[model samples]
Target: MFVTESFNRQLDDLLERICSKLQISSAQHRLAQDRYETIGNWLGARESPLAMFNPVIYPQGSLRIGTTVRPCSGQEYDLDLVCEVQLDWRQVERPVAVLDAVEQRLKKYDTYKTMLERKKRCIRVNYANEFHLDILPACPDPSSGTTCVVVPDRDVRGWKPSNPKGYAAWFESRAKTFEVYLAEHQEPLPSQEPVEMKAPLKRVVQLIKRWRDLKYADDQKIAPISIVLTTLAAEHYGGQQSTSEALAGILAGIVASIPPRNQRLLVLNPKNTKEDLSEKWDENPDAYEAFVSGIIAFHQSWQDIARGRGIPSVSATLRDLFGEDLTKSVVKEQAESIQKARSEQRLHMQKSTGILSGLTTAGSVSVRSNTFYGSQEVLP
Candidate 1:
């Protein structure tokens, strides 16, 4: 509503580009479905509880978009088709073993098993084409607290459910609320309301997103892809946005556009690993080195900006911006001075309380030991 015109066009172009690339031709969808259903059938045949394919989570959206928004273009987050399996409809086991077995079973097919591997929580299968499936092994565990999702050998702490249907419902609810909030706070939507809404929303979204990218990268020291998505929900009403939005926003801004120094943290291009990560970093060492320095410098700049803004959470701000030791130190002389003062006060208090007297006061000479002590001692 109140947004600049250029920002609106950019948003439209981005969404259009993303959606166009994601259009599911019937043939392609059918193939994906065949593979998905085949995997499901395989799991069910294993006497595993009935498996269901969730359509909502398939084409990863804005979160994945954020991953690609970095300066180095080819860094892509995986497109995950998360399959939630009801193993007994009560709890899910370490489906890694199942994934292992499934990969083995599918290996002979050769069409589907080349890149399949059991990652932390899922069976990741790479297709001959660029598309991939992150077949997350899940069983409902009430002990998983409110989320009811569990990953074996991994702490379930701070994890949330990503079921497509459930997440879609949640997102729809949030979108409705966000739309309402926008209408109330901003000018009335244009006759072409949908078109009009696109720009401001896009700019704000991107700006907030850029901020999130920064905070997650620089301050939180979180994984790049993680910061991208988490920052999105924090910046916009993505149904799943939680209480952590404020912190997410702060962290995102702090770490925006950071060139990753750690090779382990780099997300290589899915199609060409060497081209995306190794070769680029190796060839342009000077540029990459400059990029890292720039990130740290920008983080410092954000610290000043945040301080100026009077944002709370000092610990978080400090962690993201730069490394510094804020802990107060106790120098020996200072400790001695403090201890002497405390002993004198203690002696004075004891004298006032009518406790044992004729005492050597702290910081006074001890006759027997011939030593100057900082505490009181009875002369008796």
Candidate 2:
């Protein structure tokens, strides 16, 4: 379903609310750790052995916690409590059964009920929603021979697993490093004292992730999102600027870019803003057109580079064409080099083909003319 303008605005508001709620300004690691510990205690009291789950039990589907280092939107302040368990769980028990167990366990917490219910379509959720916590459960595909996979909700069936251990270990280690990092940086912890990642890049990642989600939420394809992300990173961090400036600048761009369509996806205060935001639809047709057109351009540019049709330059004109994305430019340089290498290979092959063709023609002429019969200099 297409997200309406009001919903998009709501999502924007929601993002800002989350950022404000992230009380741990300095000790991000501590904030994350505290939340995990709170969740852990809740889980322990509710489901001990089952909740006592190790980060590596499944080797295939382990659990971990981390700051939203790489969110779909730049300001989408999020924390993930992910579980990567064995794929065999499906065959042994069933996906529904696993979901039921998780849902039941979550119900024990009054704070997690409402939010969990909203995610029912995505996963089995309950209620008492406060913080922005996402429970991503993943398992490997037994038949496909893949290592691990995950789906946002149990309703659909596609899984992805990137750094199983790293994800699961994030929760356990973030708190310690966050405190140390903050102390070193001379920043104050927020009143809430939330856990945060000590690494500066990780926060930047969260900002980028927020934009990614927002862009893709508008459309499933990733061209424009990739470009904008790359461009922003390059322009902000390319020279004398500090990582902090880069992060803040990117965050500003993302919040400013929220589409009007997203407004309909909002779950709160749906009635009040409907009329005013709706009129902007006709008023800002150009802006809407530009957003769509930008994505199309990004898609075409990427396709051209892939097919050896363009300059193979990623970060140069292509990024400027879209907006910004650090990933594409960094990857673009390598892609261009690879394309050049392949072109050289084709030239070498063509030269060899020409040599063979000439040899074949010369041999045929000599045979037909009967001038090669005693040519000993020709050597066999």
Candidate 3:
């Protein structure tokens, strides 16, 4: 599905086009939220055994931060949830009990019993069509202060500190620094509302994630996890007006963040300083190096897209960077959009290297095709 065959067109809108493709549609967002909410309600019901603990279910990870990428064509979208039971950490003698309890509760239901799959830290209830919920059983972390919880870690046979709420807040604070509004309406939910206009920082993380997915479609073990990428992207993101510029800056910053060969690059959770988000890197050093390589490759492909000339060449590079199907669809849509804008006499090329669709830049040139019955095309 490599698409560098024959289409001659400028690719100034490549990054913007890709951004449009990355977000979960409003309907998709609602559907995922609805499914998770149903389980959350079922778990917190008065009839449920855990009702006395004041259990609450809320989203974490990409969904929490409005950076959730639409999974590749037909891929399962993960909804990370914290099934927090209001109990002192000391109440549970063995930290594993909490996780066991959550799993046991879910298993009681015939439907959930079939869908449930126990992982090291969470119980995943996988839906058939491109969605799954990973619910981590946690208790209040009073020792660490607000919004911190201790979730059972099967690998360590103990509880690990996490602050998904705090982390989301921190991420949102960074995003809010640069206020942006889009005309398009975004789907909303109370706990973790998707962004109305995806901030440049969010877009940066999304683009990085999309690249990681495409890069590690088969080699997921080596693929950089979303948390690490999001943390680094947020830490490095300086408020840039343009999405492309923001992405470029974030990539450069991450590349710069890599440590010397002897030392591991440590990414600490912003909310819980004691918790290192990049701990997985310690388990597999090759994964860290692989992440570094992926970042470099992503940066190069992005740069190529920015400076791309012919549409076909850009399409091929995009297919290499993202996947073939997604790249093809986005490119086709962008081409149509551009064609429509041009027909309506609203198309204008940005003076500074980019020839965008429908946006009129200051000192912009009028674009037109020089076709006298199959003649050379005129430059804008």
Candidate 4:
């Protein structure tokens, strides 16, 4: 495969760019933020019935963890959120009533009334092609202190335990551990770098989600849930420096973590021990099998990607892993970026590993400006 430090780094940067494209745009994020904040204000307003309970609305899922990906189905992006009120779970009039209260308050506003759609767990505000806001109504769980919340689940007509805030904090702690290591090693951490830059772990999660979405586009019933993927990735992550390395390691860890086919998969909520994130797998054994086979194939594809050389070959592999259209666009853009960097006399080739990148590195040489078109296309 002739993989070297420089080659691996180049691959890492390629993956990084792909991850960036898969993410929600900054403007999209801003719009979602504005919409959610306005909804938050309205939900907590004094005129609202639940205002007496002092409701607080905030983001909880992918957006909070920075692993949110753009939708591939020409559908709206999801901005998962929670509206937690200061109602006591013990004295609540009705557990499911909290959901009704939220739905009613949102319905009172004409804008939300038009946008709102009721679900088993949340009230979704669809925003067409942009993004949708899923606001889950919740109340505090006294047994677990402040971080724990009991959210309505209509399937059971009972409150379900969840800790999105706590789970986010845990993910940050895991990812930050690597950032600290990188900083100590004299490398710029993702936080200290450009806003588009993501830590390796987050990038890996983004890629997995993208893969899962595409691979199960028609078979959503068997697709693994975001929480299971995110939790497993975060749990098994060992702070690898590059997205490629982290992806490989995390996949292997998750594969090893799964039990024999006869045994059930138990992915418990990290914040709350009582909650099993993979509970749905128990009811649909085929879903578990699908997850197992899907990840196994994904891991094998990633392994093949490591062996691939050049933009065209790697791009082909990535097309199968992700999709053809997105991969082609990213590949073309990256190739142009490299060409531009070379023309500006800014590209460097690591002498030891022959890695060509815009960034300067030790034991590397600048790619000289050349005019011979036919003979100058070695990298291509």
Candidate 3 lDDT, 56-107, residue by residue in tens:
8999999888889888755677889989999888767888888888888888
Winning model by lDDT: 4
lDDT of 1 at 243: 17
Comparing 1 and 3 on lDDT, the stronger one: 3
TM-score per prediction, in order, is: 0.40, 0.36, 0.84, 0.89
Residue 170 Cα positional deviation in candidate 1, in Å, after optimal superposition:
6.2
The local lDDT score (0 to 100) that residue 278 gets in candidate 2 is: 27
Can you give the lDDT of residue 115 in candidate 4?
A: 88
Candidate 1: C-alpha lDDT: 0.38
Q: In model 1, what lDDT does residue 328 have? A: 13
Q: For each candidate, how many residue pairs have backbone atoms clashing (under 3 Å)?
A: 17, 69, 0, 0
lDDT, candidate 4, 1-380, per-residue tens? 11223546656767887897898877888888899889999999988898999998889989999999999866556889999999878787578898988999999898877888899889999987678889999988868856988898888888889888888898999899667876788655458655554688898899999999999888788989998999999998998987888998999898888788689768988888777889999889999999998898888887887776655656677898878888877766766666667778788888876766677768878888754332323352
Model 1 regions more than 4 Å off: 1-77, 88-95, 101-110, 128-131, 145-147, 153-177, 181-223, 227-380
Per-prediction RMSD in angstroms?
A: 24.1, 22.5, 5.7, 3.6
Candidates by TM-score, descending order: 4, 3, 1, 2
Worst 10 residues of 3 by lDDT: 1-10
* Candidate 2 residue spans exceeding 4 A from truth: 1-24, 27-29, 44-76, 85-87, 118-130, 140-147, 150-153, 157-380
